[model samples]
Every structure is written in structure tokens, then in C-alpha cells.
Target: MFDVVVCKKKQEAENIYSFELTLPEQGYLPKFQAGAHIDVEVRPGLIRQYSLCNPAGKTDRYLIAVLNDPASRGGSVGMIEQVLEGQTIRISKPRNLFPLDENTGFTLLLAGGVGITPIIAMAEQLQQLGRDFELHYCGRSRTSMAFIDRLRHSPFAAKVILHCDDGDAKQKLNLDTVFGATPEDSHLYICGPAGFMDYVLGQATDSGWPEARLHREYFSAPDVASADTAGDEEAESFTLRLARSGKELKVAADQSVANVLLDNGIEIPISCEQGICGTCLTSVLEGIPDHRDYFMTAKEHALNNQFTPCCSRSKSSVLVIDL
Candidate 1:
């Protein structure tokens, strides 16, 4: 972890603010790639991940934007209400779960609302590399969109298309037009609300776009029924075996594996307990995991070698994990 000072805080859009963080000495920090995010210690025991919105190669400062979400579980609220300019905060090194595939022949970038944070970095990287790419930014309205003027005056302005729900029908996003035909070597990267992402993913799938070519990052996990409400078949108690210590623990139906381990004095670093973040991802030594996380792709889940313990449980009666 590093202590970075919040150099500036500016309101970007309606309830959205961008923070510029820099080292105390104003020196270069660790280099990060596009789609990389840092874990900010919002408050004691409250760490939240925010995407790096600044250019990847620029190490002088790191930029992140946070939307004061109504449904936020304290992350955004704390950032907007408590954090102030010139305040020093603790943050983890950059981690990239949503990496950009620069080798693709063509790239399609899609952003909705605050999701534009990572998409902007991707566009900057693509422009720097002289890669062929187009960006489509969608929002509820012009006033609700962040960095509109910046994008409009950017060097790659011509490659960008704006879509507003409250604007003219012609300016609204048409998935059919955005995705006419799937190019063999083209890749699509999407980051947005769960509903927006689901709609885009569904449309892309229906348009014959292979899952391999479609990438996405979700700010929060979609609402899903809990284990208790999943019927007795899925809510059965399970046993967990720690590989290194050879210790065993019982995971009750009403409890999560993370809580069970924590109660036993076994610490597993966890950020987003909802499983949207991959911080608590653990390896499975022997049993299959009933993967309940949005962090890993479907193919990764099918491998059954790893799972996020924060929200995922084991399918096998006794599962061995690499603690």
C-alpha cells in the first residue's frame, strides 16, 4: 500500500466526481496498463476498487472517478462526502482484471454512465498505439454524462459516438447499428451498469459474436437469490479442508465461506464481499466450487480450479482449498 495525496477533486457530472491522486513527493508512481484499477482504503475496513481513468503511460498521477450511486454500499458515498482535496489516503498497487487486448485487429469500446472511466483509458492507449478502435459512450442525458467536453475535444474525437436517452431518437444507441457484423479479429469491451451490460452481452451473443471476443467489467454484481433462498439442495452445509494446515471447517447454510474462515482466525483478503472484485479468489485443490461470482468468466468457472470464497461455495460435500 502507498499513501497518495488527493491533489484535486472536480465534479465531472451530476453526482460524479473525479479525483487526481499523486505521490507526496510528486514523483512517478508504479506504471499501470489500461483497464487497471487500484484499491482505495475508503475508511477503516472499507476498501473499494476504482478504475484508472488517466493514460496508462503517465505515472505522475492516477485519476479515478466515482459516482455517488444511490445503491452504493458506502464506497461512493464515503468518497464524495468524506474524502477531500489534499488529503492523503492509502491505496493498493494497480491491478488489472479487465485488461485490454491490444493485438486485436479492431476494438469496440462501450461505456454507460460511470463505466466510461476505464473505457477512456482504453481509448487513450489505443490511440497511443495507433490501433483501430471506436468508442461509444451512452448516458441518460448530456448533463448526466461525465467528461463530455474532454471527449469532444480529444485527439480521437472522430472515433467517438455519443448516445443520450433524453436526446433525439437518432442519437440513441442502436445495438443493431453498433454491431452490424462480427469481425473475425475484432474485440468488444463493455463496462456499465448490470442492465446495460446484460443488454449489450445478449445482443452481441444474438449477433453471433463469440464469447471469447466480448469482454466486460461490472461495477457491482447483479442481484441474485441468496443460498438460503436457493432451496435446500443448494443450501446444504458443506465441509472445507485447508490444504496447507490440513484443518477442516464446516460451512453452514446461513454463513458464507469467508465468514466461516474469518471466524476461525484464517484471514483471506477480501474487498468487495459481493464477489465482484477478485481479491478473495482462492484455488480449489480437490472439489468443485458452486461458483457464484461475476469476477471469473464462464470458461474459468467450468475449470473448477478456483473460486471467490467471499460469495462462492462448494458443490462437493468436502472441498479441499489451497489456503
Candidate 2:
């Protein structure tokens, strides 16, 4: 864990706030590239991931922006109203699952709401490298957009496009026009609300964009619709076999593997229990897993060697786990 002090905080938009963190010793912190995020430990056990918005290869400080969310479990509210400047906080090392693909000929960045964090970093990198790219930022209105002033005054302003819900139909985003002429070597990166992502992805797919060409990251895990819980009696039960200790645990139909493991005095580090954080990833020694988490890629899911037990279960009758 790296201890960093909150040096500056500013209200960027309506409910969005930007924060600058620096090491207490005033030395360089860890280096992070575009699309990397650091997990900030708000309280004792309340850890939330925030994307690093600073330009790539910079290590002097880390920049993050947070939106005040009333429906938040705790992280956003604590950071917005409870945490103060000069107070030190612990943060995890940088991790990136959404790194920019510099090999792509032309990059199209699509951001909705606060999803501009990573995209902005990518845009900065692209500008510095003189790569061909465009950033389309969308929000409810101009008052709700973060970093608008910065973008407008920056050298990359010419490549930035703003779209608001209050704008005219002609000024609004037309996914078809944006993606219809995309070349085979072009790639698209998206981050935003579930419905917005679905709409954008659906339109892109209908326009013949391949899955590999479209990359995305979700701020929150998509709701995993389970089969009817009312029919628990009809649901199938599974067993977990530990390879290390050779211990077997029976998992009920209505129970998750993590819950059953905890009940049996086995502890597994988990966060977001929704399988979005990849905190509880465990190795699968044997058996097929009914992959459910969005953390792993399609190729990783096909390998079937690792699984997040927090919400995912076994596809076979029994699963052999490393621990």
C-alpha cells in the first residue's frame, strides 16, 4: 500500500469533483499508464477503484475524479463529504485491464458521463504521440461535463467533440455516422452507463464492428440475472473439492461458493462481491466453471483455469480448486 496525501480538490462539474494526490515525502509515486486504476481504501474495509486521469508515464502525482453518488455503498460519499485535503490515505498499486492499443491505426474514444476519466488520459497520450484519434464526450448537459474547460484550452481541443442531451438532434451523437465508416484497422474504446453502453455496442455490432475491435470497461458490474430463486428447491447443488487439503465442501443450490466457504471457516479476500473487481480470483484445478464475472476476458474465460468464486459457480458436478 502507498500512502498519499490529498493535496488538492476541486469541484469540476455539477456533482463531479477532481482530486490530486501526492506523496507525503513529495517524491515521485508509482508510474501508471493510461487506463490504469488504483484502489483507494476509504475506511477500514471500504475499498473502491478510481481510474488515474493523469497523462501516461507521469509519476509526480496521481489524479482522480469522483462523482457524488447518493446511491453509493460508501466510497464516493466518504471521499466527497468526509475525506479532507492534507489527510493521508492508502492506495493500491496501479493495475490496468484497459490499456490503450497503440497498434490500432485510428482510435475512436467514446465516453458517457464520468467515464471520461480514462478516455481523457488516452487522448492526452495520443496527442503527445501525434496519433490519429478523436474523443467524443457525452453528458446530460454542459454543466455536468467534467474537464470541459481544460479540454477547450488544451492543444487537443480541435480533436474533441462534445455532445449533450440538451443539444439539437443534429448536434447529438449519431453512432452510425461515427462508426459506419470505421476502417478495419480502427478500434473503439467505450466506458459509461449500462444502458448507454448497450445502445452503443448494439448499434456498432449492427454496423458490422467485430467484438475484438470494441473495448469497454464498466464502472459497476452489470446485474447478473439469475434463474428464478423462487424455485430453489429445483436448483442443482454442487460440490467443491480443495486440492491442497483434499477437503470437500458441499454447496447448496441457493448458496454461493464464497458464502459456503466462509461458513466452513475458509476465508477468501473479496471486494465488490459482484465479481467486477477480480479480488477473489481463484485457480481451478479441475472441472468446468460457469463463467459469470466480467473481470476476465473472453480468452481467459475459455482457458477455464481461473475463476471468481464470489458469484460464479461450477458447471460440472464438482470443481477442484487450488485452495
Candidate 3:
């Protein structure tokens, strides 16, 4: 963890604020990539991940934008209301779960609402690399969008296309027109709310876009029911065996694997307990994991080698995990 101070803060849009964080001692921060994010300690025991929206190559400071979401479990509220400029806070080094495929011939960056955070960094990096890419930003309205003026005046402004729901119908996003025939060597990166992402992904899929070419990051877990207990009346009790300690713990039907482990004095690092973050992903040595996380792809879940213990349960009665 690094101790950084919020150097500056500005209201970007309605209920959205941007914070610039810099190391107190004046040293460069660890270099981060385009789609990297850092975990911030919002409160005593509350941690939340926010994407780096600033230019990627620059290491002097990290910029993050937060929206005061009404449905937030507390992260957004704490970040917007509690964190102040010049306040020192703890944050993890940048980690990139949604990294850009630099080798792709062309890129299509899409952002919805506050999901523009990571896409902004990606646009900067792509421009610096002289790569072919276009950015599509969609919002409810012009006033609700963050970084509108910044994007309009950016060097790559010509490559940006804005679509607002309240705008003219012709200017609205048409998924069919935006995504035509799939390009062989082009990739698509999308980030936004669950419904927005689902709509975009569903359209892309129906258009014959390959799963490998479609990339996305979710700010919150979707409302879809977990495949683990889709039709089941209730979750079944399971046994978790620690490989290193040879200790077995009973996971009750009403309890999560993470909480059960914590109750047994076994704590695993966890952030975003909703299963959107892969912080607590653990390898399964034996038995199958009833995967419930959006972090891992379906291919990874098919292997059943690792699972997010925070919200994922087990299919097998006796499951062994690598501690």
C-alpha cells in the first residue's frame, strides 16, 4: 500500500467528482497501464476500486473520478463526502484486470455514464501510440456527463462520438450502426452499468462478434441470478478443506465461503465482496466451484480451477482449496 494525498478535487458533473492524488514525498508513483485501477481505502474497513483516468504513461499523479451513487453500498458516498483534498489515504498499487490489447490492429472504446474513467486513459494511451481507435461516450444527458469539455478539446477530439439519451434521435446510439460487420483484427472495450453493458454485449454477440474480441468491465455485479443456485430452493452446506493446514471447515447454507473462512481465523484479502473484483480468487485443488462471479470469463469458470470465495459457493460436498 502507498500513502498518497489528494492534491486536488473538482466537481466534474452532477454528483460526480474527480480527485488527483500524488505521493506526499514527491516521488513518482508506480507506472500503470491504460485500463489499470487502484483500490482505495474509503473508510476504516471499506475498500473500493477506482479506475485511473489520467494519461497512462505519466507517473506523477493518479486521477480518479467517483460518482455519488444512490445505490452504492457506501464506497461512492464515502469517497465523495468524506475524502478531502490534502488528506492522506492508503491505496493499493495499480492493477489492470481490463488491459488493452495493444497488438490489435484497431480498437473501439465505449463508455457509458461514469464508466468513461478507464476508457479515457485508454484513449490517451492509444493516441500516444499512434494507434487507430475511436471513442464512443454515451450518457443520460449532456449535463450528466463528466469530462465533456475535456473530451471535446482533447487532441483526439475528432475521434470521439457522443450520444446522449436526451439528444436528437438521429444522434442517439444505434448499436446496429455502431457495430456493423465484425472486423477481423479489431477489438472492442466496453465499461458501464450492468444494463448498458448487457445491451451492448447482447447486440455485439448477436452481430457475430467473437467473445475473445469483446472486453468489458463492470462497476457493480449484475442483477442476474447466480448460475450456482439458479433453480435450487436453497444453497447446500459444503466442506472446505485447507490444503496447507489440513483443516476442514463447515460452510453453512446461509453463510459465504469467505465469511466461514474468516470465522475460522483464515482471512483472505477481499475487496468488492459482491464478486465483481478478483481480489479473493483462490485456486481449487479438488472438487468443483459453483462459480458466481463476473470477474472470470465463462471459459475460466468452465475449468473450475479458481473461484471468488467471497460470494462463490461449492458444488461438491468436500472441496479442497489451495490456501
Please give the CA lDDT of all the candidate structures. Answer: 0.92, 0.85, 0.91
What's the C-alpha lDDT at position 69 in model 2?
74
Lowest summed lDDT over 10 consecutive residues: which window, candidate 3? 224-233
lDDT of 3 by residue, 1-323 (tens): 87999999999999899999999998899999999999999988999999999999899999999999999899999999999998999999999999998888889999999999999999989998999898999999988899999999999999999999999998699888877733556799999998899889888889888889999998998876755546225789999999999999999888889998999888899999978879999999999998878888888999999999988888899989999
Query: Could you tally the backbone clashes for each prediction?
Result: 0, 0, 0
lDDT of 2 by residue, 56-150 (tens): 88889999999897668898899998778889999988988788988778999999988999999999998888889989999999999999988
Measured by lDDT, the strongest candidate is 1
Model 1 lDDT tens row, 233-299: 5577899999999999999988899999999999999998887889999999899898888888888
Better of 1 and 2 by lDDT: 1
Which pairs in model 1 have colliding backbones? none
Model 3, total clashes: 0
Candidate 3, position 297, lDDT: 84
TM-scores vs. true structure, each candidate: 0.96, 0.91, 0.96
lDDT value, residue 259 of candidate 1: 96
